[model samples]
Target: MTDPVLRLEALRHGYPTPQGRLPVLDGVDLSLSGGETMALTGESGAGKSTLLHLAAGLDTAESGVIEVCGADMAGRDDAGRAALRRAHIGVVFQQFNLVPSLRVGDNIAFQARLAGREDPGWTAELADRLGLSPLLSRWPEELSGGQQQRAAVGRALAARPALLLADEPTGNLDEASADAVMELMLELTRTAGCALLMATHSAALAARLGRRAQLRGGRLCDETGAAA
Candidate 1:
């Protein structure tokens, strides 16, 4: 089989606490091929977010390696890792992370501009597809929660990153809005040929993805098949 677009091998990470170095992930391994969508499901504080952070290069692994689009992140310095993330990773967080001052259109194009890859046509298309066309000129604070989330999704996908990491992208939306956003996210990620790794608490959401994995006791395992 071809190598995965994103891979984590023997990954371990933790944060310091008064007691000790509290391990968040322990020897976790995962792989995602191009156009594949994998749902990460687990209880609260099950290291789902930590795994996503490690995969996105937002945090470092204590031991092991994270490879994105064939580049080994383990050897890179912070700047190098940042460059990789900017160029090849798209992330959506539960908070939406939209800039209050920027208009919806500007927020959608921000990352692409940062990467020197702003595509006006792509941005327009994304805005239309995400149903943000009418709100393009409005500031983030003026939009509803679903609208803000949609803008965030558009922003992350506009850059056409090789890997897409989403942490509960639909967590705050109502059922109808959540389903709509999930459909749009899945469709757009497929169109972009990106690998998707989403951490969610919803079993129904996980069932929609190509595969499902559960995080528990600081490790990840396939929920439907044998352990990876």
Candidate 2:
């Protein structure tokens, strides 16, 4: 494969507990090419979210290296990592972390503005594609769950970041709405040429992606149950 947009090597992370450090991820390694969509599936507490955090620079690993677009995160400070995330990464969570005070349009444009690349044309296109154009002025509280999720997705993709991380993005939606939102997300991500690492529990959803991996025993493995 070509050089990966995001790569992790021997990643290990854990939290403090009474019994010493409770390891979450253990020696995890992954590589994602640009415009590739990979689904991560596992049971609850399988370290899916933790791995996403490490990939997106939201959290640090205990050991090993994480590289985004060829920049190693191991030696970077908090501000540096944050800057990297702002420049080349976008994340969408299950909770649809939209700012209640900002309108839908503003929320979608927020990260782009922070990145100092707020292109009006791109933002408008995202709004229209995500079906948020009619409700651009509405607040998060005024929308349905599906609408809120769509807005969150639009916000993440509007900046055209090199990497997009999504955690249980369709967990709260009904089957029909989930299918529609997933289709839109796939289309938008492909159009933007963003590498997508999505953590989901649905096998059906995982099957739809270009590649599927599972998080088990504190590591990521391929679809045929072999280590990747």
Best by lDDT: 1
TM-scores for every predicted model: 0.94, 0.94
Q: Write the per-residue lDDT of candidate 1 for residues 6-112, one digit (tens) a residue.
A: 98989998899999999889899888999999999889998988898888888877999899988988778899989999999999988889988899999999999
- Give the C-alpha miss distance for residue 149 in model 2, angstroms: 1.5
Candidate 2: global Cα-lDDT? Answer: 0.88
Least lDDT summed over 10 consecutive residues: which range in candidate 2? 184-193
Model 2 clashing residue pairs (backbone):
none
Error of 1 at 13 (Å): 0.7
- In candidate 2, how many clashes are counted? 0
Q: RMSD for all candidates, in order, please.
A: 1.5, 1.6
Top candidate on TM-score is 1
